[model samples]
Target: MSKPKVIVIGAGIMGLATAWQLAKKGANVTVLEQSAVPNPVGSSVDDHRLIRYPYGDKPGFVAMVRQAFGAWDEMWADLGERHYHESGTLVFGGPNTPRAKVQADVLATQGIDVEWLSPAQLVRDYPLLMLDDLDGGFRLPTGGTLRCGRIVAALYRHLTFQGMDIRPFTQVKDVDPVTASVTLADGSKLTADKIVIAAGAWLTKLLPDMASRVTPSRQIVIYVRPPAGTADAWRKMPCLLDIDGGNNGFYLVPPTPGTGLKIGDHIFSRQGDPSAERIVAKAEAQAILDKCAGRFRNHGDYRIIEGKACFYTVEPDEKLLIEARDKALILSPCSGHGFKFGSIVGTRAADVVMGAADAEQVRRWATGEAP
Candidate 1:
C-alpha cells in the first residue's frame, strides 16, 4: 500500500508542526500557506510566548502542556538552540477568582511544584507585582517563554529538508472533502488522500458553515521598553500572569538580549474577521499601557515600541475542536491561548490524519485523560 498523501492548510505553528509530523511518518505531505511562512500577521510572530504546565481548572490542558514541554525540549536539542526559557511563571490573583484558584488547585493535585504565596510573600519574592489586597499567588517553577517566530522558522526549514513540499503564497479557496481535492485561489487543484484544516483564524473562511462555532477575535501585543538603567531588573524577571483583582490576562516574557518586555491582555472575546481585523488602535494600545503602568514594578514611561494585532479563532467554551468532518479532519485549538501547544498539538493532529488515533483520544488526554 502506498503512503497516504496529506494536505495541510495554514503555515502557522500548528499547521507547520502538523506537516512536519506527517512527513516524518513517511506520508507525502504538502503544507499550503496563504502568506509567507512565519507571517507577522499571524499570532505566532511575537518575540516570546508562554510555555507552561497547569492550565487553570483544566487538567486536560495541563497534561497537554506537560507533553508539549517535552516535545519542545526534543526540538531544542535537535535544532541545537535554546528555544525555551526556564524563568518559571507566577499566577497571582484574588482567592475566590475561578481561574486563580483553579490554577493553584490543579498544580497541587498534579504534584506540580508550585508555591502558593501570600501578598507579603509575593512582594518579597517578586516586587514587581502590586499585591495590595490581593488574595494569593502561585508559581510554576517549570513555566517560561518560547521564542515563537524562531521556532516556526526552524520547523519550516526542518520539514523542507525532510522532502515535504511546502507551498508559500498559496491560498486555499475551497476544499472538496468528498473528492479529496482542494481548489487554490489561482484556479489550480491538488488532490490528496487526506486533508487537515489547521488554518488559524481563516478556518471559517474556507468552511463558512463553521463560522458560528469558531469566531475569530482581534488580539494585540505591545512591546514596552523598560525605564533606562533598570533594564537589567526587568530582564531578570520571570514570565508572569496577573490573574488577581479580576484581571484574566498574563505576561509571558521579560526583556531579552535586545528585545524589550512584551505585554498583552487575554480579554479579547469580541468576534472579528481575520481579513478585516485592525492592526492596532491608539485607544486599545493605551489601555494596555495603562494596565502595565499600574501593575508592573518600577513602572516606566512606556512607549508603544511596536504593536501587532492578530486573530484568535476562539471557541465558545475556549476548548479546542479536534474532530472529523466527513473526509476532512479539523485540528484547531481556538482558545485565545493555544499557540503554546503548537508542537504537541501538531503531533496529535498527525495521528488523527493517519488513522493512528481519533479525535476523542486527543480530547480525552487534553481534557484529563490519565496515563
Candidate 2:
C-alpha cells in the first residue's frame, strides 16, 4: 500500500512538528520552508522557550500542559537525546496580589505540589530579586525550559534520516485549500493528498481571508548577563512569571547550563510585517528593561547580550486556532503562549490529518473549549 502524501508549509516548530508526526505514521511527508528549517527568527528557535503550568484564568492549558510533557518525553525517546532542562518555575506578584496565589491553588487542585511563598519568603529565597511591595509567589517543579533550537535542529536531523523531503527557501505564493495544492513563488505548483498550513506569523500572508482573525505579533526578547555579585543567584534562578499585573509582566527563563537569561513579555505587539526586517530597535529593548527595572537587583550592571525581534500569529482571545477547510487544515497554534504545547499539538494535528479524529473536536480542544 502506498503511504498517504502530505505537504506542510512553514518549517517553524508547529510546521515541523506536524510533519514529524505524519512521517512517523507512515506518510510520505514534504516540508516547504520559506527560509531554512528551524528558521532563526522563527518563534520556536531560541536559546530557551518556557513550559509552565500556571495559566491564571486559562484552566484548559493546565490540562494540556500535562499532556505536553508526555508528548515531549515521547519525542526525547525517539531522538535519543533529552533537549529539556527542568530546573523549576516561579510565579511572583506584587503587594496585595491574589492572581499568583490563585495560580498556585489551581495547580494544587490538580494534585501538583505547589509551594506558596510570602513577600518575606521571596526576599529570603531569591535575594537577587528586588522584593519591595511584593506579596505572593509560588514554586512548582513541573515547569521549566525547553531548549527550542536544539530540539528543532534534532528534529530536522531525525526527519532527514527518515528520508523526508524538506525544501528550504521554497516560498509558497498561494494555497488552494479546495485542491490541497500550493503554488510556489517561482510559479510551480504541487498537489498533495492532504495539505497542512502550520505557517506561523505568515499565515495571513498566505491565507489573506484569515487577516481579520489572526495577526502577526512582533515580540521582543532580550538576553542579559547578570553582574558578578548576582551570577550565583542567577545560576539557581527558575523560570519566572513576573506578575505585577501590568504590560511589563514578562516571563523569564533562567540562565541554566548552556543557556542565557531570557526575558520577554506576554503582551502582544499586535502588528509587524514578518517579511520585513526583524531588527530590534534600541528603544524597544530598553522599554522591556525599563518595565523590569527595580525588579532585579544590580539591574544597571546587567549586560545586554542580544535584543531580538520575533513574530507569531495571535488571535484576540489568544487560543490555538486549529481548523479545517476541506482537505487543507489550518493549524495556527499561536499567540504568545504556543511554544509550550508544540509537541502534543503536532500529535493532535496528525490525528485530524489521518482521518482518525474529528476536526471540530480538535478545534474546540485547541481553543481550550470542551473537546
Candidate 3:
C-alpha cells in the first residue's frame, strides 16, 4: 500500500507541528502557508509564550501541557538550541477568586511542586508584584516561557530538512472534501489522502458555515522597558498572570532574551476579520502601559516599544475544536489560550489525520472530552 499523503493548512505552530509529526511517521506531507513562512501577524510570532502544567480547572489541558513540555524539550535537545525558559510562573489573585483557588487546587492535586504564597509571602518572595491587594497566589516551579517564533521556525526547518514540501505564500483558497484536494489562490490544485486545517483565526474564513463555531477576536500585546536599573530584576522575574485583577485578565512575561518585558490583557470580547485587524493603537497601548504601571514594580517610562494585534479564534466554550470535517480533520486550537499547548496540539492533530487517534481521544487527553 502507498503511504498516505497529508496536506496541512497554515504554517503556524499547530500546522508545522502536525506536519512534522506526520512526515516523521513516513507520510508524504505538504504544509501550505498563506503568507511568508513564520508570518509576523500570526499568534505564533510572539517572542515568548507561557508554558505551565496546571491550567486552573482544565485537568485535561494540564495533562496536555505537561506532555507538550516533554516534546519541546526533546526538540530543543535535538536542535541543540534553548527554546524554553524555566523561569517559573505565578498565578496570583484574591482569596475567593475561582481561578486562583482552582489553580492552587489543581497544582496540589497533581503534586506539581507548586507553592501557596500568602500575600505577605508573595511580597517578600516576588517584590516586583503588587501583592498588597491580592489575597494569595500559587507558584509553579515547573512553569516557564517558550520561545514561540523560534519554535515555529525550527519546526519548519526540521521538516524541510526531512524533505517535507512546504509551500509559503500559498493561500489555500478552497478545499474539496469529496476529492481530498485543495485549491490554492493561484488556481493550482493539490491532492492529499488527508488534510488538516490548523489555520488559527483563518479557519472560520475558510469554512463560513462553521463561522459560529469559531469567532476571531482582536487582542493587543505590548512590550515595555522596565525602569533602567530594574532590567535585571525583571529578567529574573517569573511569568505572572493577574487572573483576578479588575477582571481585566492581565499577564506578563519576562524580557525575551533581547526584547523588553511583555504584557497583555485578555479582556477582548469583540470579533473581527483576521486579515484586516488593526495593530494596537496609541490610546489602547497607553492604557495597557498604565495598567502595568499599577500592577508591576519599577515599570517606568511606559514607552510603547512595540505593539501588535493578534487574533484569537475563540470557541463558545473556550475549548478547542478538534474534529473530522469530511476527509479533512479540522484542528482549530484558538480557544483564546491555545499558544501554551502548541506542541501537544500539533502532535495530536497529526495523530487525528493519520487515524492513529480520534477527536474524543485527543479531547480526553487534552480537555477531558467535555463531560
Q: What is the lDDT of candidate 1?
A: 0.76
Q: lDDT rank, highest first?
A: 2, 3, 1
Which RMSD values do the candidates have, in order? 2.3, 1.6, 2.1
> How many residue pairs clash per model?
4, 0, 1
Indicate the worst ten consecutive residues by lDDT in candidate 1.
Answer: 243-252
Write model 1 residue lDDT over 1-371, tens digit each, in one string. Answer: 89899899888988888887787677899899999988777767667778777576877778778788877776677666767767777776645757777777777777776777777887787665566656767776677777888888888888788677899999999998787789999999999998888888888889888888878788777887766666777777778765434554546478777466888776764666778746687877767777665576666556678776777787877877776776777866757778778878788888888888876777655434542
Model 3: per-residue lDDT, tens digit, 1-371?
89899888999988888787787677898899999889888878878888877676866667667777777766677566768878877777644768777766776665676677788887888776667877777776777777888888887787788778998999999987767899999998999898888888888778887786778888888887666667777788888776544655678888856656888876765567789946568887877777766676655654678877878787777777777777888877766777777776777777777788776777555554432
Tell me the tens digit of each residue's lDDT in model 2 across 44-126.
Answer: 89888888888876667888899899999989998898988887888777325678666766776766777778878888998
Error of 2 at 319 (Å): 0.5
TM-score of each: 0.92, 0.96, 0.93
TM-score order of candidates, best first? 2, 3, 1
Best by TM-score: 2
Q: Could you give me the TM-score of model 2 versus the true structure? A: 0.96
What stretches of model 3 exceed 4 Å from their correct place?
Answer: 94-98, 245-247, 298-300
Per-residue error for 174 in candidate 2, Å, reads: 0.8
Q: Which model is ahead, 2 or 3, in terms of lDDT? A: 2
